[model samples]
Every structure is written in structure tokens, then in C-alpha cells.
Target: MAQPYADTIACIRKSTAEMRDLQRGAMDLDAPGTEARLEQTVRELQARVDEQQAALEQLRSSSHVDIQQVAYASGNPRDKLKQLRAVTAAYTGLTTVAPFLPSKDSMLPALLAARALQQNIRGTKQAIASAEAQITANGALLKQEESNLHDANLIEKALRDRTVRLEAQIEDRSQKAPAQLAKELIAAKRAEKKRHDEETQRLGDALNDFVDNYLSAMLAAEELGGPVVGDMLNVENETLAAGFTKKGKAKATKKLVSGKTRQRRIDQIWGSKIAVEEEEEAPLTEAEAADAEMRELIGILFKTLTGPGGGRAYHQLERDSAASRFLIRAKIAQFHPKDAQKLRLIDFGRELDD
Candidate 1:
């Protein structure tokens, strides 16, 4: 299962890791070198414009003198001389300032280039703006993830504390009467184990069903041109199918054995089955159930001390509230440790007093 909060946290972390890289890219777009290059280009264009203006001014200042020289040197009729002078002066002006003229060919192209540069600068600014927005969004997501983690931590802590307290109570209770309590605790432990095994089996069954459905969906998707392809598709489908089939079978077997009839059969075959069978005949009140659970926990602890591979099992049980309590009681009863304190009886005579 994908936890959204956890995934969000992961994404946030990934974003944070890439922040420096993205920032670097953004910085490069407007770096000192880039800015310097742009400035240099603009300066060169300005210098060209200044030179053109100077040449145009110089041409305008000499146009009259050139016309007069042309008229005086031509030795022709007055009308012809005037026409020649006028034509020569016009030609001189055009030739002198032609290179400096801001032409339709030159000015238009320069204007377009300048506009393109401006657009690039605008795009860079927009990119920076987008990055900043992403950063803000990522920051908020990270904070939410942290809050979720904190809440989960608190819940885990509460569970742990309750488990520990229950264990201590069971320990104290078992010490009050060793032999009798031990037997009762053993029976309780067996019942508790049966429940735990059944619950675990149920969970396994559900998980198997989920896996099978998921695989079937994936296979269907692959057939429909989804992501699955080639060897990857074949391998994944085979692996998933095999695992789901095996788990489904195992869960079914466990569920079959979880019934009351199976319990009776086991009891008939095993004469040494503890006397706690009476509690299974009827649904217990909340108080009775709790006590029964605690006794079962103690029984588990006793088994841990005497049975093979029981130490680790006992330790694991201690981590669970109901299981831990039962183990503690069983341990206190079986060992009859002197330092173990008796549990204070509540008004219901079931729960340990505060």
C-alpha cells in the first residue's frame, strides 16, 4: 500500500534535494556573464547609432559647398550648369551618407533582435517565479507530512504504554497464587493464541485476495497497452500469480483450522489441553475477557521459559498489549518470583487498581 502522506514526504525531500540544482540553473540564465554579454551587444549598437549620426551631420554641412564647386567647374550653359550642379550635389549627399543611413534593412533587423532579447529576459523572470511557487508548495507539503508523522508517533507511544502497564498488572496478579494461577493462565494463553492465530490468518487471507486482484488488474491493463511489456510483464505476472496462489492456499488452510470444531478435535486428541475450554463456551463480558487475555499472556511467558524458541516469541508478545499481559502473568505464576508485587483489585475484581 502506498501511504499518501509518506509519499508526499518523500516527494518533498526529493524536491528539497533538487532545490540547489534548480536554483543553479535559474541563476545561470541571468548570470553575470549573460548580463555582461547583453550589455556589450547593446553598447555596440549604441556606438553604431552615434557614428551614423555623426556622418549624417558631416554630409549635411558639406552639401552646399560641393554643389557650388560642381556648378563653377562645369563650363556649360547656365541652365545646363544649374541642372548638373543640382544633380551632382544630390549624388554627393546620397553617397556620403549612404553607409551611415539607418536603412529599412538594418534598423528593422536590429529592432527584432532587441525584442527577442527582451522576450528572453521576460521568460527567465517567469521561470524564476515558477520555481519560487514550487518551493512554497513543497514547503507546505513537508510541514503536513511532519505533522502526520508526529501524530502517528503519539499513537504508537500510547499503545506501547498501555501494553507495558497491562503486562505489569498481569505479573502482579499471577504472583498471588502460583499453581492455580499457572493452570488458569495456561488455559487463557491457549485461547489467546488461538485468537491471535485466527486474526493473523484472516489478515493473510485478505492480503492474498488483495494481491490477486491487483495482479489481475495489472494483467488486464497490460493486455490493453498499459505500461507492462516484454520480459518485464511476463516475469512480474508469473511471480505475482505464484505468490498469490500460495498465500491464498495457506490462508484457507489456517481459516479452516480456526473454527470451534477444529478446536474440539484438537482438544480430544490432546488430553493435556488446559481447562480454559469453559471460557470458550460463551461470550465473555469485557472484564472477563480482559482477565482471560491477561492470563493467556502469562501462559505464553511460561511457555517461553520452558519451550524451544520461546524466548524470542515471549519478547515479541511483550510488544502487544493483550499478549504482553498474558505472558507476564504466566511468568510470575510459573516462577513465583518473590519480588513480583500483587495487583490491586478493582471494584469489579477483574482489573488492577490504579
Candidate 2:
């Protein structure tokens, strides 16, 4: 067999042996190791017996040949005389040529030499026939063995292909099956959501920073004689807006430019401060401080963006201008994702403007 196929078969056999061992272990927990050793000893004895049997067969085949005699012992006297005459003629012919032939012993008896040469020729013919039979048998056996090897190679290839398929299935089940894909998808989604949340948080922080700076700039501008908007809705103005029509005497007696009006407005403005002076002031929570800061920033931005006449500066920008695009992007980033998606669809295939 080829080396690779031999290795494959070895691997398969090893795997089969391991599986058999596991099965045997499961089937007989109390099986002794001595029993296995005994089985191995029996197998070895069987192999030795097979080898001896093959050797014995070869010996029997070799011993079956008969050694031919130089002369027949149970023939008629006339036939025996005839055979003697033939031997005499052969011996005479050999002696005549003996002077020209190479010989180890020149004085050896000619009759005995003729008889020995006759036996040797008969034995050689028998050996040649036996050798020819053995050659034919060997050729058949070689062809059979070649066929067996081809079959074994085919079986090995099939087993190797099956092993590859089984391994691929196992790999897919472990790493690419539906459950594995689902797990991967879930992990990817979680990662995407985490990234999205982080980006949103960063954008919010940036917006907050920008709002703080804008607020500080607006405050400085106001200090430099800008339009007064910080006190747009003071307590007195709120009171006047309420119209003072309630049946309560405090509301009914409220009049503009009166001492009571001034006192009520001052009281409303400083009520929390006065209460704090009377008792220990509690510190504001983080949420409360954030809300106050947000409210102040919103108030300033709202007043600045909307003029005293309540018309927004946003309404004055051209529809496709840079300022409009910035405003649109800011609104989309802030709170209009769904609307932005729709707008993006509408704007698809349209030429972009400045």
C-alpha cells in the first residue's frame, strides 16, 4: 500500500480499537486485565500454528516427488535383456566420446556413468515441470494479491472521505451551526449597541459643553449692555399676567405700583432664601442642580434665538443653506432620528445643495 493510505488505515484501526476498548469497558466493568493478556497469548499461539501449518504444507509438497530408478526390477527377462542391450549401446557411444569430453575421473566405469547420467536427466525433467507449475501458481497468487490491494485502497479512500465529512460536520456544529451563529449575532448586536450608546453619550457631553460656553458668552454679552432677557418673567410680571380676578383678598387688592404689590413680589422672589435663613439649608442633589443649570441654559438660548417679537431666527434662513443644513443635522442628532430617516429617504437621488 501507499504510505499515506497505510497511515490512514492505521489511524482507522487505532480509532476502532479505542472504541472497542471503551465498549468493552462499558460492558464489563469487572473484566480483568489478565483475561486480555490471555486473549493476546491465544492469538500469538494461533499465528504460530498458522506459520507451522504453512511450512508443513511446503514440506509435504516437496516430499511428494518420487525418485526414478535407473532400471526396472519386475520386468520380464527378455525385456530386461533388451534394456541391458540398450544400456550397452549407450555406454559404448559415451566411451567413444569420452576422450573428447571433460571428466573429473577418466578411469571411472562407463556403465555406471551412463546409468547415473540417465537418472540425472529424468530428475531434471521432473524438476523443470514442478518449477513451471510453481511459477504458474505464483503468477495467479500475485494477481489475486494485486486485486486485494486495489480493493483495500478503495476501502481506505472511502473511509478517508467519510472521516473528512464527519470532521466537517463536527466543526460546523461547534463553530458555524445555527446556535453558534445566533450566539455570534447576539454578541455583535451587543457590541454595536454599546458603541451606539457610547457615541450618544459623547455627543450629549459635547452638546452640554457647547451650551455652557454659549451661556457664558451670552451672559457676558448681556453684561455689556445687550438686550435684557434674564428677568423676562419676574414675579411682578407673572402676577400681572395672572389678572388678579380671584375672590381672595390678597389677589383682589393687588394693584400695580402699590407698596403691597412691591412687598408681595419681593416676598415671592426671596421666599426660599428667607426660609433657608430660618433653617439649615439642605444641599441640592445632582439631579436638581442639573435641572437648574439646564433650565437656565434653555431660558437664555430660547430668548436669544427668539427675538423680542417672538419670531425665531431659524425661520429666516434659506431652506438649502449651510445654516439650515446644520440646524437640520443638529435637530436630527438631538431628537429626530425617525424623522431624519424619512427625510433621508425623501432626499435620496436628489442633488445635494450648499
Candidate 3:
């Protein structure tokens, strides 16, 4: 029977051969999983080689050394020969069982097999390295795409937020449109009406006051000098009262008076007297009248406070008293509220009787 060590070596040899065949098959197939399988097979074969080498070392340490002793101790020469032959046969069997058993260089077939295995492993490793590099590059590309998507999403969100805010502002402005326009129109109309009313009132007041003062002054003058005062004073009444003469009687009397006698009598009445010459009244031009009318219109429009008279009465009063120095100051103070405050004339000189 073959020694147990020989059987074990034979098993190792067979396993190694099988590993080599698997590596070759993997290379031929060149499938996706081939590289991984070939690498696994190479590792297993390397392990087996290590195990077989250890086994060989153990066998050489005891069994092989004792084989010679066993051969020598045999008594019969035939038995000794047979023992030697058995040892020799055992050695031969070990050699055949694993050609590369004693050392790595022992078998030509094993060396060739190992070399083929190494080449296959190297090729498999290179394929794995290439695959891993491609995978790494693909991962980088995926990360870049993800980053770009993130940036695009952020920009879209910001634009959406801005659009929302703009829409809200537009909606708010639209809602307020009618009310705002109405308010502005109402304010403008009110201002225009106020100005017109005030101007009308001022003109009415001025006209009324002017007429009243003029009539009063005329009456006072008449009261101061009676009808015959011109004869008593012996003054040239023609120059002093030309326009004031009565229509029928006064015109005839002035024509009957002799020219030289009239001159002498006028000189005797008042020699070198300062004569009050009536200023020639110039009629209002078109431009002046237009300006006056416009002023009246403005005053009528803007009279906020009611004056002494209603609108018409105030307009007349303003015209009549317009030239009176005292009344002008009073009217200015009355019309301008600021002037009234500065002058402290809130009550218009009205005092309560105690």
C-alpha cells in the first residue's frame, strides 16, 4: 500500500493542478466575475502550497530519516533488500505524487503551472485595477452632477421667492389703486372750490366798503361847506368844484358870470391860494380789468372764513375799502391768518362790557 504521506502529497498535487486549471478557465471565459474567481483560486493555491511544504518538512524530519534505519535492522538480506526497495519506492512515489514537493524548483510541470498561475493573477489584478479606476471616475462624475443639481435647485428657489414677493407687492398696489386716485381727485377739487369762494368773498367785501366810505366822505364835505359858501369865501368855485355842479341852474349861472369880474373876484377871495387840482382819472385798461377779475375769482374760490358780509357783500366791501390805508392793514390782517396771529387780533377788537 502507498504511504499516507504519499497519498497526502498526491492530494495536494491534484488540488494545485485543479487551481491552475480554474485560473486558465477564468482567463478563457473572461467574464465579469472571472478576475475575482481567479484571485480567490490563486490565494487558495498559495495556501495549499504552504500546507504541502509544511507536510514535506514534517515527513523529512522523522519518517525519511528512520527509513534507512528500518532497512538496516532487517535480519534477512532479502528482507533488507525488500525494505530498501520499499523506501526507494516510497521516495519514487513522493516524487511522482508532487513534482514540486521538496522545493519549488523540483518539478518542471509545477514550475510551468506556477508561472502560468502568476501571469493569470497579474492579468486579473490589472483588470481589477482598471475596473476600480473606472468606478472611481464614475463616482466623481455622479458627485459633480449632484452638486450642479443642488445649485440649480437653490437658484430656482430664490427666483421663486423673489417672484412671490413681487406678486404680493403688485397685488397690494392694485388693491389700493381706486381709493388712492379718488382721494387725490377729491382733495384737488376741494382745494379749487375753496380758492374760488374766498376770492369772490374778498372782492365783494372790498366793493361794499369802498362805496360806503366814499359816500360818507362826500356827505361830511357837504356838511362842512353850505351851498352859498363859494360866494361868502369869494373863491373861484369853477376850478374847485367843476364836476360837482348841478345840471341846469349851476351850468347857467357859471355861463352868465363875466370873465374879468370872475377873475378879480376869484383873486380877491383867495390870492395865490394852493389849488387842489383834481387828478385826471385814467380808466382801467383791458389787462388791468382782466387781472382784477381774476383776483376776484380767486378770492371767491378760496374764502374759507365767512367775513362781515356774505359772498357778494364781502366782494363789494373789499373793492371799496381796498385803497384805504387803515382798512388795507386791517383787511390784510383779517385775510391772512398768520398776520392776525402776529398782531394778536383774534377777537377783532371786540371787548366784553363789565
What are the RMSDs of all candidates, in order?
24.7, 32.6, 39.6
Per-residue lDDT tens digits for candidate 2, residues 175-240, read 677887888789999999999999978976786675444333332222223322233222232233
lDDT per model vs. reference: 0.49, 0.47, 0.49
TM-score of candidate 2 against the unseen true structure: 0.21
The reply for model 2, stretches above 4 Å from the true place, is 1-108, 179-354
Residue 314 displacement in candidate 1 (angstroms): 30
Q: Model 1 over residues 1-354: C-alpha lDDT tens digits? A: 235644665665565446546645644765676566656666767989898789888987977655455545455688667777778898988887745434432334544655675576566556656766776788789889999999999999999999999999889886777788788789999999999999978975774464344333333222223334222333232232222232222122233223454334323322222234665665322223333444444445445545674232222321223223222443332222232222211123233211
Decoy 1 TM-score against native = 0.22
- For all candidates, the clash counts are 7, 0, 45
- Superior candidate under TM-score, 1 versus 2: 1
* Model 3 RMSD, rounded to 1 decimal: 39.6
Q: Give the C-alpha miss distance for residue 348 in model 1, angstroms.
A: 39
lDDT of 3 at 54: 99
Where does model 3 exceed 4 Å of error? 1-108, 178-354
Q: Sort by TM-score, best first.
A: 1, 3, 2
- Candidate 3, residues 13-128: lDDT per residue as tens digits? 56666777876674566555555555555666788789888988888787645655673658889977887888889898877674433333223344467687788666755665
